[model samples]
Target: MSAAPQMNAQHINAITNAAVIIVKEHLGMQTGFSKPYVSGSQFMSSDISVVMGVNGTLEGQIICTMKNQTALSIVGSMMGGMKVETLDEMGWSAIQEFGNWVAGRAASELAKAEAAIDISPPVINEGRSTFRVEKTFLTIPLTSEAGEVLLHVSITPRVNE
Candidate 1:
């Protein structure tokens, strides 16, 4: 872990918008951005996702997390049925793939802007009910037929100057 990634309002907005586009486009749902949740000792926890950060010039994370219901609905929608009750192996895989797509989309957006961006492979977690981030700079809320999950982008950018 190098120094935490630092980001500004513009970068935050850019990342948020790009990430949201990826989810909405895939799940046919809309992701909302509300007041960010702060982090401290034993802070709130949500989903654990692939945290990609570019340390050379800019630094940030492309975090993705979806609730079980959300994941199930998304998986169900993709498979053309709502009969699915839970996220099976196939449903889990669907969530991971969606995570990759969103991360990749965000990276593409940054790359198009000529920003150095590094992305990590998607990491799948079960509920992340106890996971905690030391930093809470940015957060995004996604809503689907399943449910809503929060994506908190905790980056300590290097370009604070």
Candidate 2:
């Protein structure tokens, strides 16, 4: 792993899989979640992008995003159903919970690799799906009987510092 700003594919996979495992193990889901996809987004609508700050030598935030359909399916399975037609308030609440789980898993995985990164609690966010070159991100497609979810992870250095 080339550290934060220049993360290698290994490190990225570690974090992405951790989140996927959390969703499956915790939510009792059984399916195949696709490998992580690292790409730029033309727009950021129709998805939830959450940023979590990490304070350290290479500081940045992990931005996790997912589409409405994915969120609804995951949330519905979490609530003992899979045919989620509409994403109601309860869906948002559940999505937040999922985000929380993902953040915790990512942070823990990083820590195990001797990367002292602290992730703040998940927060709802909206923005474009783009990042700098030295920047690194992970996009995972979660597959399940319920449906598939695209989880995006972006890493950038702290500019405020």
lDDT of 1: 0.61
The predictions' CA RMSDs to the true structure, in order, are 4.0, 4.4
**Candidate 2 accuracy as lDDT:** 0.63
Write one digit per residue (lDDT tens) for candidate 2, span 1-161. 34444554555665777766876787777757665556553324235666566565336556656666666677777888767887677876777777777767876776666666667777765443544434444566767654565565555434443
Worst 10 residues of 2 by lDDT: 38-47
Cα deviation at 24, candidate 1, in Å, is 3.0
Task: Give lDDT: candidate 1, residue 11.
Answer: 57
Candidate models: Cα lDDT each: 0.61, 0.63
Best candidate per TM-score, number? 1
lDDT (Cα, tens digit) per residue for candidate 1, span 75-135: 7866765567877788777777777776667667766666666666666767565545455
TM-score of 1: 0.74
